[model samples]
Target: MAGRKRNSAEDIVRKLRRADELTAAGKTQEEIAGELEVSAATLYNWRRQYDGMDTDAAKELKELREQNGKLKRLLADAELEKDALREGSEGKILSPADKRRAVDMLVTTMRVSKRLACRAVGLARSTYARTPIAQTPADPDAALRTILRDYARTHPLHGFRRAWAHLRHDQAIAVNKKKVHRLWKEEGLQVRIYHPRKRGGVSSCPQTEADAPNVVWAMDFQFDSTVDGKAVKIASMIDEHTRLSLMNIVERSIPAQRLVEEIGKTFALWGGPPLVLRMDNGPEFISSALQQFCANRVGISYIAPGTPWNNGHIESFNNRLRKECLNRNHWTSLLEARVVIEDFKDDHNHRHRHSSLGYLTPAEYAAPCTHTHQPVDGREID
Candidate 1:
């Protein structure tokens, strides 16, 4: 059996016009249907549907229908794009893994097609379809990561380079520093860096550069309080060349005499006084007692009254003490503060890796210096 032919809007309109002309020419409906080669039912149905419509009107209707369909398709695409963007807005979709996750979310939750999800997330379909390679059981970085995690736990204040130094030197693990840095970031062990505000104006006082151990010693004071609110004063002195913390004196208050005595004790314990003592113009440092003590034993290089940068070595040490020790521990009594502070000073000398010292501890760096003197016993104070 032959199937009936489907006519478009324009063809139907032309056929209907022809049928009307034939009807006006005294032709029967059956003849018109025969002439048009359509069934009587089809011709009747076309007339009923396209009644009172011209060919131009039918063409306009067809155009309108096509335009409407195109608009609907465009709107759907737009909606899919909007949904994909919203899904990826939680954070930056920087990595391929992140984009894959976004595509999966859109496909699963929004019921969108994989193609559309990939397009919306700015990922290629092939990339989205690709599977990630799995890691093997014998990972090279496993041991390094374990060591790094332990180092990070113990020294929360140290950065990746310091950790690398500890691994290479202390642990005898020969790994690249860059590899350590990458693992450090992956393990979330990177320390937050503090950026100091830039200040203008140079100090009038000339700075002294230390070329050898025991050449220049910098001394400074830091203040804190016990839990009961009694004031705790700290006096820190360090060898500028070797970066060794010579002494840290913690007490309720240190007058000129006490300060002079502590300096004398530090000098005797460390095998002698430095040639030059770098300090700020504090009352305890500038008093006649301290001035006379320095005049006989060491020369005083007082920085400009307000410029602490002239004594930057001791200032940096104080900052580390405050950050790593004092800020982390709260002391209920003066004795506890002294004990904890002493332990920190010893750790800094023997264990802390200094970047300027090529990641070596101060004690280790000073050990090779010929001018460095050996310390005597009975150095502990009550």
Candidate 2:
């Protein structure tokens, strides 16, 4: 039906053009109309119709021709554009089957093939195949902080693969495996050193003291050797209740006189002599002067021997000292080492945290300042 309408419109245009040509050749409208076998009114109508013909069918035909020309040009342009896109992606060596397989794999696994990926990324085949991806640069300070913190908290999965997984899931860092591996290696984020393995079950100190701070004191010594074959021992005393190291001193040896002096000094600084003085089975701790000082002079009872584990406070401090200070430095001289040790002790006591002491420093722990010994006679002190 549409085709028939178009054909009728074309016939009208042709007849109108012929009528115009006759009028232009000096034939009157009446003669032109009479030749066409119409009445005088119809003849005037034909002239009017011919005059108005230019406004409708002719105009519409001209517009359609212009539109048809535009559509042809646009079709040519579209073909050229397709050719350009195909040319840009044509270096792939993949067969038709391979291409289909590659596309399917990419959609399924969300991974593209080497050749197709190179094309998709607008890189040369050789360049994409050989060139390594830029590894994500991890902040060294952040990784180190994580290592130390996790080690302290005894996190089960404390190394890089686990850490990277954590970074991906918790922190939303979308890093690829190879890139993460490279950065992990470059940053030395893996756990290279392991905790010294023990044969039996780990030993823990059982709390056996009154609730107050100064009721029980634990003392121990750490030995550090000088380059000249001279050994220095650091005698440290800590309050069991508060986990506060009351005394820390580096000496040539753990002498009985020196130990006595240190115990006196600790008592002078922070009053209230401990009721029970805990000691390991070391010779320095068992010295006559140390025994006398605790027994007769200080009037403090001694905890059982051969059990340094009873001195948990000082042992914990020793672990911290080893990790934060001794492990981090290599000292040349005894005096240099002593100064460093003193500085670390001061820092630990005044600044660093004690987890068992509610993350407070030793000074903060010591601030409460009172000890009420629970009498064993089923009675409490007022």
Candidate 3:
């Protein structure tokens, strides 16, 4: 047989707390009884017993109830703060309309956050009800087709946003970033993968120059053979700023004596020596005699090893000389190579249209000084 139920002080306290929650929710006695797993009679009896009791007289018990209330409020406030912080981080703010749209999207997608869904629809929680929600894309296919057709030709590697930017800036096509992103996804256009560049060894002498011609010079050697099968070295000095061949000498070997003699000849012809002469780390360049000549005789500074990109002007000119002239023909003798190199040099400095000199020939680009033997600024041809 079941024992008769008795309401204890603990039971009274638990019922009182449940009653407060139920009352706040506007639930009646029947609803409270159902929620608390108690019979309607039990709920009514408990309410009658405790509802009129002096809660203050049980001060110690009341303190526990008040503490529970404070804890619940604190938890609720923390959750709100957390939600607000998340929205702020994502550049989203909630208004009345945002709340409704978020609720709707959550019902539909069941994946995205409520704040994010609201942001996607451009709704604010505070003013969502007042403002109409922005419409989603009407014709997604048309948008994708247009984006691909316009961008796929010139910028076949463009991603959605880049394609979108190009369209807006270059083609005068106007669209939102989100819409462009969607179209990009649908079209499957993306940037090509590329390997990262690795750092490499440096060249000995650095190529340095000023704004004008005759300021910086670059010297390099070309190996040639004599009729008797002996090797000869052709030392050429090129003006970095002007793209002019200041000195072109075909010698048996680049001895210190021969090199100094050639330098004096070049100085006499070209007027004055350059501020700097960029050269390689070969024996001809780094020899004690050459080093002494550069430091003491010429009073020029030398750059350290293995960096060549600094001498871009000379490098580009060398490439042109090789591709157009040297590579096109073979030399049977050193004299033949010297003759060809000299003829090519004259043509390059006098007749050839230089793109860097604004399409002007070297002679046309080089400014003629009215005074005797003065160096002139060379202009780039467009």
C-alpha RMSD of each candidate structure in angstroms: 7.7, 19.5, 15.2
Candidate 1 segments whose C-alpha is farther than 4 A from its true place: 1-139, 370-382
Runs in model 3 deviating more than 4 A are 1-207, 224-230, 296-303, 368-382
lDDT of 1 by residue, 191-233 (tens): 7868687455565655456767987899999999999988999
lDDT of each: 0.85, 0.61, 0.63
Question: What is the alpha-carbon lDDT of model 3 when measured against the actual structure?
Answer: 0.63
lDDT of 2 by residue, 85-154 (tens): 3544446644333344343444345343444444443446655343233233554446544543454354
Q: Among all windows of ten consecutive residues in candidate 3, which has the lowest summed lDDT?
A: 373-382
Sort order, TM-score high to low: 1, 2, 3
lDDT of 2: 0.61
The number of clashing residue pairs in each candidate reads 0, 0, 27
Better of 2 and 3 by lDDT: 3
| TM-score, per-candidate, Cα-based | 0.73, 0.47, 0.42
lDDT of 2 at 194: 53
Tell me how far the alpha carbon of residue 333 in candidate 1 is from the true structure, in angstroms, after superposition.
1.4
Superior candidate under lDDT, 1 versus 3: 1
Model 3 per-residue lDDT tens digits across residues 210-282: 4566666778777756657777676777876567878888766778767877887897788877666676566
Please state the error at residue 189 of candidate 3 in Å: 32
Error of 3 at 329 (Å): 1.8
